[model samples]
Target: MGVFEVKGGRELKGEITPQGAKNEALQVLNAVLLTPEKVTISNIPNIRDVNKLIDLLKSLGVKIEQLNDDTYTFQADEIDIEYLTTPEFKEKGGGLRGSIMIVGPLLARFGKGYIPKPGGDKIGRRRLDTHFEGLQKLGANFEYDSNTNFYKTEAAKLKGTYMLLDEASVTGTANIVMAASMAKGKTTIYNAACEPYLQQLCNMLVNMGAKISGIGSNLLTIEGVKELHGTEHRCLPDMIEIGSFIGMAAMTNSEITIKDVHYDQLGMIPQVFSRLGITIVRRDDDLIIPKQNHYEIDQFIDGSILTVSDAPWPGFTPDLLSIVLVVATQAKGSVLVHQKMFESRLFFVDKLIDMGAQIILCDPHRATVIGLDKQVPLRGISMTSPDIRAGVALLIAALSAEGTSHIHNIEQIDRGYQYIDKRLQALGARIKRID
Candidate 1:
């Protein structure tokens, strides 16, 4: 496992560019398998999870070429469908949650798909029922082998039908939409995830000859097409990373400009940060977060305690709740961080409490952070990262603490952020990777 040695009490300054959207990259990469033509993708982040998916695609015989550092061209014309039966495929597919998405495209083009139970963050029970259930509604027969924990779906020809999703899951919606794109009839998905990631996927699919409407709405209509052709796609900048940078700037009292963030796509992120009393200046596509000595959390209009909760898109993102919790540790007032989506995400608050922050773990789902108002600086301590978001949140806390902090299991952090230590170093942050 990798570790990060972050020395605190230093301010980071300079322009830091957010990487390509990790969530979007995972969705769009799998979309390439829907077409036989060359699909070129740019702004792909060099992260572990995305790389793992790319390698999985290669193992399934997708001809992938590197156009540049952050660009790739993929052709899935010569896929080895039998490769899915190999133990090697099960091991590789089981390692990544995003690998489950490949089954959608493979099923659409090749009539059958197989995958081992996928693995990802240990935040909570991330069920695959959403993905498999949605696919089953599209005329695919779903079967599970409990002994091997493998999932298989097959259909001679998928005939689309209207269905209402139980939850507007982003990955679930993406998987279903991909399969439904090539189904035999019109498919309508109500209460679908309208996140920017899903919007990008819909737009890319439309460009590839799939007739998809309702680009930014909860209701989507896809007129099934016989085939889809490849096209170019550029992923939006990671909004989660942008939000983390905003919190980092306030916590460290640093003036940092995040470049080319695709601000409009970052729904509710800026407003949520502003609620924490942080100033965000927009210059073209960049967000300029000025240094602050002491930022204050805002109370509700009724003078109630401020509550920061995550919801579906257009609401605050759950991924950034950890960052919000960490940033609130140095702020001037108290805020309740409610992580409604994942039960175990708030479990990392004990580490912040150990760092001299005033935080009360209300439960597995909520934490009330009483800001120290910068009166007492957080002292660094050794900690282990539990998940990607929590790992980055802990890193942000370490950066603002009084002394040197050691964070173990930094591979969790690397799974999402690209060259995070190097990026922070470029911005003058005293961060090092100790492998």
Candidate 2:
């Protein structure tokens, strides 16, 4: 495992170009399995998760050629279905949550697919019931083995059907969309996840000859086609990174400019951060975060602490709540950070508290952060990453600490942020990745 060592109290400054969205890239890569023709993907983030997905695809006989730093040409001309059934494949497949999505597409194209339990942030009970339910609605039969935690699905020809997802799971919505695109008739999806990543997947499918209506809305209508052809597409800039940079600039009292933000895609993030007393200036595709020495949390009406929570698209993202919680420790007033999506995400607040942050973990899902108001800079300490977003939150906390901090399990951090140390280094952040 790798660790990140950071020397704190430096104001990060400079221009940073946000990397491509990891979540969107994962879906885009999996979509390539639907066709044998060449598919060119540009603006891909070189992150750990993305690399793992690429390796898995290659192991399944997909020929991939790297065109440049952030572009790749992939042709799944031949898929080795047998390779996907191997124990090695199951192990790697189980290690990533997104790998579950391949089951639907593989089953749709190959008539049968097998997948072990998928791994990701140990946040909560992330159920695959929605995915299985949606696939079953499209005429797929599934068998599950509890001992091995393997799920197998078989369908001769998937017939499109109207399905209402119990929850708008990001990956669940993605899997159904991919499966429905090649089904026999029309598919209607209600309560779909309309996040930017989902929109990107929809657009990519449309470019591949699948007719999908209601691009950015909760209701999606898909006109199934005979088959999808290869198409070229570029991923949107990572909004999570954009939000992280915004939080970093505010906490470090730094003036940083983020480039290629895709501002329109980031619906209400800017305004959400502004509630934390951070000033953000939008310049077309770029976002500028100005330096701030003293920042106060904006309270809700009735003179109480402000509460920031997460919701589905067009709402604040759950992935960013951890970063916002860490940033709140430096603000002037108290605020409540509610992580509604996950049960255990707030447990990491103990690590932050040990660093002199005035945070009260109300429960597993909520924490109250009382700002030090620049009265105290967090003392440097050694910590281990729990998950991806929390790891980034700890990195931000370490950067704003007093002396030096060591963060272990950097692989979690690498799972999302592309070239994170290098990108933060460019912004004058003193962080190094050591093995």
Candidate 3:
């Protein structure tokens, strides 16, 4: 396992650029399988999970050419569809949660798609029922093999229809939309996930000749087309990373600037951090977070304790709740972080507690953080990263603490963050990668 040796108590400086969206890359990269034509994508993050997916595509015989470090052109003109039945495919497919997305496009074009049970962060139970059930409603046959732990879907000709989703799942919505794009008639999806990443996917599909309406709303309408062509796309700056940077600057009492972030798309993120008493000055597309020795949490309008909670898009993202929780440890007031989507995400608070943060784990879903207000500084210790989000959160904590910290299982962090230690080191942070 990889480890990050981070020395604490130094304030970071200089400007940092957020990488391309990891979530959007996963969705759009799979969308390349929807067409046989060439799809060129720019600003793709060179992270472990995305690279693993690219390798998986290569294994499926998708002709891929690397244009640069963060760009690729893929053409699925000749796919080895039968390779999905191989043990090698199972092992590769099971390693990535984004692997499930290939099923929708494959089933639409090739009549069949197979995948092993997908794996990702062990934060909580992420059900595949949303993906399968949504595809099943679009006239695909869904089957699960208990003995083999594999999922299979097939459709000769999918006929579009209206369906209401049980939840606004981002990946689920993207999967069903890809399948529906080539179906027989109009498909109406209510309660779809309308995140900016999903919107980017829809826009890319539309550019490729897919008839999609309601690009940025909960309700989407797709008119089936016989085929989709290819188009060039550039992913937006990662909003989660942008949020993490904001929290990190405040935690370490540093002045930093985040560049080229699509400000309009980052709904509620800046406001939420500002509620934690962080100053975010928007200059053009850049966000300048000035240094502050003490930032306080804001109370509610009724003078109640502030509560930071995660909701679906158009709300604060759950991915940054861990960052917010860690930042609040140094604020002047308390805030309750309610992680509604994942049960096990809050479990990482115990590690923060060990570093002397005043946090109360109310349950599996919520944490109450009482700010030390810099009256007491956290002393660093060795810890293990549990998942991608939590790993970065812990890294932010360690950067602001008083002593050195060793973080094990940093592969979890590398899976999402691209050259994070190097990036931090550029900002005067003393971080080293121990391979």
Candidate 4:
């Protein structure tokens, strides 16, 4: 296992370029299986999950060539469908939750798809019934094999139909959209997840000749065609990474600038952070954050304590709730951080509380953080990462602590952030990655 030993009490300063969106990159790469033509992708993040997906694609006979460090050329001209059923492929697919999406595209184009139980951040119960439900609505038949815990889908020809998802699950919506893009007729998806990542997937489909209306809204109308031709598309900048950087700068009292942010796509993230008294100045494609005193938590009109919560897109994302919780530890007043989407996400607060943070874990879903306001610096301590987002949160806490801190199980952090130690080192943060 890898570990990050962070020497704390350093103000991170410098310009850091955000990497491509991990969520968007996974869906876009899987979409390559929908066509035989060459697809060139730029700004790809070099993360573990993406490398695993790339290896999975290579095993399936997708020819991937590296044009440069952050660009790749992919051609799924002669995919070996049998490769997907092997133990190696199944094990790789089981490591990434997003890999389940390949089942839809493979089923739509090749008549059948097989997938093992998917794996990801163990934050809560992630149901694949939504994916199967949406695909079933589009004429796909699903079968589960108890012997291997594998799910298979088969459909001779998928016919478009209207689907109202049980919940606006992000990956579920992406799966159905990719499958429906090559179906027989028009497909209307209601109550869909319209996060920026999903919107990028929709836009990529449009670029590939699939007709998708309502790019950034819940109601998406996709007019399925016989086939989709491959086209070159650059993945969007990662909003989650951008938000993480913002939180890092705020908590450490650092003046940093994030370059090449897709400002328009980051709908309400800036405003939401502003409620916590962190001001972000947008200059063209860059977002600049200045050092300031402790953040002030905004209150409701009735003078009640403010509650920052997550909902589907056009609302705050649950992925950033951990960053918000960590940032709130340095703020002035109390704020309720509710993560309704995931049950175990707030359980990591025990580690933060041990560092002298004034946090009250209301339950599995909510936490109240009373900020330290620069009066007391968090002392460094040894900790274990429970999940991806919480691991990053603990890393942030460790970086801002007063002494050296060791964070074990850093593979959780590597799953999302690409070369995080080096990236932070460039910004004057003393983080060393050791095995």
**RMSD (Å) per prediction:** 0.7, 1.0, 0.6, 1.1
The count of residue-pair clashes in candidate 3 stands at 0
lDDT of each: 0.95, 0.91, 0.95, 0.90
Superpose all Cα atoms of candidate 2 onto the true structure and report the RMSD in Å to 1 decimal. 1.0
lDDT of 1 by residue, 1-435 (tens): 788999999988999999999999999999999999999999999999999999999999999999899999999999999999999999999998899999899999999999999999999978888888889999999999999999999999999899999999999999999999999999999989999999999999999999999889999999999999989999999999999999999999999999999989999999999999999999999999998997999999999999999998888999999999999999999999999999999999989999999999988999999999999999999999999999999999999999999999999999999999999999999998997
Checking candidate 1 for backbone clashes, the offending pairs are none
What C-alpha lDDT does candidate 2 achieve relative to the native structure? Answer: 0.91
Greater TM-score among 1 and 4 belongs to 1
Best by lDDT: 3
TM-score of candidate 4 to 2 decimals: 0.98
Tens-digit lDDT track for model 2 on 308-408?
99999988999999989999999999999999989988888889999999998888989999999978999899999999999999999999999999999
Q: Which portions of model 2 miss their true places by more than 4 Å? A: none
Provide the TM-score for each candidate, comma-separated. Answer: 0.99, 0.98, 0.99, 0.98
Query: Candidate 3: lDDT over CA atoms?
Result: 0.95
Query: Which residue segments of model 1 deviate by more than 4 Å?
Result: none
Task: List candidate 4 segments past 4 Å from native.
Answer: none
lDDT, candidate 4, 174-265, per-residue tens:
99999999889999999999998898888888888899999899999988888888899899898999999999999888999999998998
Candidate 3: tens digits of C-alpha lDDT, residues 1-435 = 889999999999999999999999999999999999999999999998999999999999999999998999999999999999999999999998899899999988999989999989999979888888888999999899999999999989998999999999999999999999999999999999999999999999999999999989999999999999989999999999999999999999999999999999999999999999999999999999999999999999999999999899998899999999999999999999999999999999999999999999999999999999989999899999999999999999999999999999999999999999999999999999998
